[model samples]
Target: MKFNFDQRIERRKTKSIKWSSEVLKNMFGEEDLLPLWVADMDFLSPPPVREAMMQEVEHGIFGYSIRSEGYYQSVAKWMEKRFDWKIQKDWIIFMPGVVSAVYYVLQGLLEPGDGVIIQEPVYYPFKSAILDTRCRVINNQLIEHDGRYEMDFEDLEEKAGDPRTKLLVLCSPHNPVGRVWSRDELNKVAQICTKNNVVILSDEIHHDLVYKPHRHHVLANLKEEYRENIITATAPSKTFNLAGMMSAHVICENSEMREKLRKVLDKNHIGMQTPLSMAAVEAAYREGEEWLEELLDYLQGNVHLIRETVKRDLPKAKFSPPQATYLAWIDFRDYGIDGKVLEEKMVKEGKIALDGGTWFGEGGDGFLRVNFACPRETVKEALERIAGVLNKEELK
Candidate 1:
């Protein structure tokens, strides 16, 4: 065991959103609720990442720093060695975070009122980012057939064909629903968007966390034409638990698209890359691979624990094991309750906080997204609280 998955760390009152009293009160309306909603892991990052940050702190001078070829090489090599995607140094553009990157992409690619397509029950920020820019959100809701999610290509094609629709924000290894899009599925998306002249923005933030046998193919790397039409946002945040470091980067092969994005970044004056963040990112990709492999093993165990508990305790709930990421998409529609009612019960009655399925927009009702990236005990505790409430509610 390279790392201890059961190690518990106290985060309450640390200004951690997942554990903050004020944030919990605001989000779940309970100051003392146990939060399992945020997408970050409760585990410590890799030792190398910690050592790099410590070394930087020992120097005692946090000054402005510029990214060097080594930083770019770390990213390029990681992508090549891990995902088989050979990208160049020039293709990388550092951003504060993936959510910020989405804001910039919309600002660059679309004018006001232009339509952007996103699959429903996706990561909520995609919709938030689009609307924040005054862009119209066009929904291509995913279809769940027999507990597996598939893209609605017929609907996607129709949406893409609309001239008003200029961008499709794709969540590969999708969130909340957790189905890693297959190669053929991605090919269909590429073809449809290309045929309809819609540019594709693939958020591969969860790219490295895919579970076994479910591979993630960088959409831009699939074809030369696809490369020209795609802009990908990726980070070690989700992969290495570095979200707090505020470091993410975009990969765009199209020179013009890159230029447009750069213009938006420049307009916002957003390039403030910290020295510690740069160190952490490079160390994570260069030295954190082994830790990540072990972390995946731990996450799978957490997934299994939740699945079994749901089956035994909350018998009516439908839990389709996630193919990737630590998030689980659980369907509780059989309880015949709206997502809000289910979410409130989990928060107020169960005393556990989870992301409501309705927050993911249409088709997300009657589901909840559980982040099982914490220790096994935490997963069990949250499920037990949820089980008591759900079981009692079922008897009503």
Candidate 2:
């Protein structure tokens, strides 16, 4: 099916967290700020997903629902087809979301004050989950050079070797400064984690949205021992824009680890899946592949649009095209403003809402994360507003 991704859908009055004025006010201290912040896409989900949900809704029976065998098979098939990572259906466990799973893993697997390792300037929730669970965060900051980011194995090895460190949260095809990790890079990570007995929680949520010429490697599929020690958290939420559905798939080949994580989830009473969500998950994996391919093509176009606009208009900023995900990480350190100050200017002067670099933890200052999964026009307008503020300051 040919999808018209260029069509802009109005979301302002729809009570969307991304588009709601009240949400903007709460998050950014302004109700009318133009939004491009949240990770959810502004684009409509694939037609098959919508059609399946509509069909489920029309049935009019809303009760506790279970994911069918087909649901697990769909996830398994997508893994193999997209990443060439063959995973069995039995390893799949369901969760409401990836962020929540992090907390549960912390609660279930580690003791208070036990250390958890996370790469810096990563998805902020990893840090939040650690602190909330009373665990100390061990930072393995990524090396940034010439606008490219690489995992610092030296720092990572040093941190992982800490006897108190119990888990390492790996954001494969990492967030913010996007980097689809190479297999060789992943192998070294496995080696270090294995030597120190650190279990990996691989968040491969964006595994399917990678741009061409770059591929996503499922950490579990790399080696048998890696598979045994890794717990993977994935979802159709980001891939199919089903975040509101609150469904996630946690895959673990290690029975012992899976049981530990599962116990926490059971204690919290998290097994119910909405009927609509079940249908959506099945349809997304089985029928949405064609739509996803087109979305990636459109997303790549959005990436280019932001790259060129930042270059031509926001001359003081540095942006390298991300290798994966719909987020573009732009560096404003070229302007020499505090990261916090630049974030405020983005809202007050540029009249746009973006994720401040500091939100991602260490090394985020003087940077911003822009969500580019919306219509191209929205991205263009945001860049123009930022340019106005920066250029006006430049002339002063």
Candidate 3:
């Protein structure tokens, strides 16, 4: 089936957080700004998923539901088919979302005041989850050299060795600045965490969205020893544009660790799934591959457009096509504008809303994260707006 990724769908007044006028005003201080900040895509979901959901709607009796054998099989098969990682049905556990899974894991495994290591310029919510659980955040910041990002393994080892540090939250194919970790990097990280007896919460939510010539390794699937120490969070949300469905999975191979996390979920009454979400997730995994392949091709085109536009129009800016994910992290430091002021100019003068680099924590200043998972026309307009704001003489 040929997917029309270029078609522009109307999202306004659809209760979309990304397109809501009120949300834009509150978030960017401009009600009419062109929004390209949020991670959700502007394209419609796959036809099979929509049809499955419609079947559920036609049934007309929405009630409490339990996942069936087919549901688990779909998830297990996806892992095997996509990554060559064979996973058992029993290893999967349901969660409403990855962020909620992070909270639950912290609550279940670590006590208050314990240290959790996270790479900086990472997803902002990782910090929030740690602080919300009363756990201390230990920053093992990423190293940037020549417009590319790499892990600070020496720093990671030092932090993981701390007695107070009990967990490490890893953003695989990391958000904000996307670089898919190679097998060697994953092995080194696993060795350090396992040696120090620290649990690794490997957030592989963006695993499926990686581009060609770059592969995302499932930390647990790399080695048996790593499996015992890793808890992976995944979802069809990013892959299938199903974020509103609120369905995600937490895979734990170790029985004891699984029990601990399950206890936390059980205590909070968090295991139920919505009938609609179940249909959507199952259909996505079982029959959405054709749609996904075409979507990736479309997204890669957008990536190239951004790269070319930046080089041609904004010569002072620094950007590279991300190895994975739809988010593009571009540095505007050469413009000599403060990060806050640059973000303000984007919203007020350029009439665009993008994620400020500072929001991702340390090492993020003087940068902006642009989400390009929209129509090509939308991306072109956003690039023009960005160039208009940054290329102005007054700002420089």
Off by over 4 Å in 3: 394-396
- Candidate 1 on 1-396: residue-level lDDT in tens? 869989989999686889999988888778988888999989999999999999999999998899878889999999999989999888899999999999999999899999999999789999999999999999999998867989999999899999999999999878878878888999899999998889999999999999998899999888776779899999999999999999999999989999999999999898879999999999999999999999999999998898889989988899999898999888999999877888888988989989999999888999988899999999999889988998898688
TM-score of each: 0.99, 0.98, 0.98
- After the best TM-score superposition of candidate 2, give how far the Cα of residue 110 lies from its true spot, in angstroms: 0.8
lDDT of each: 0.91, 0.90, 0.93
lDDT (10s digit) by residue, model 2, range 71-117: 88888898888888888777888888999888888898999999899
lDDT of candidate 1 vs native? 0.91
Please provide, for model 3 over 231-290, each residue's C-alpha lDDT reduced to its tens digit, 9 standing for 90 to 100: 999999999999999999999898998999999999999999999999999999999999
What CA RMSD would you report for each candidate? 0.8, 1.0, 1.0
Q: How many collisions between residues are there in candidate 2?
A: 0
Q: Report the alpha-carbon TM-score of model 3 versus the true structure.
A: 0.98
Point out the worst 10-residue segment of candidate 3 by lDDT. Answer: 387-396
Candidate 3's displacement at residue 365, Å, is 0.4
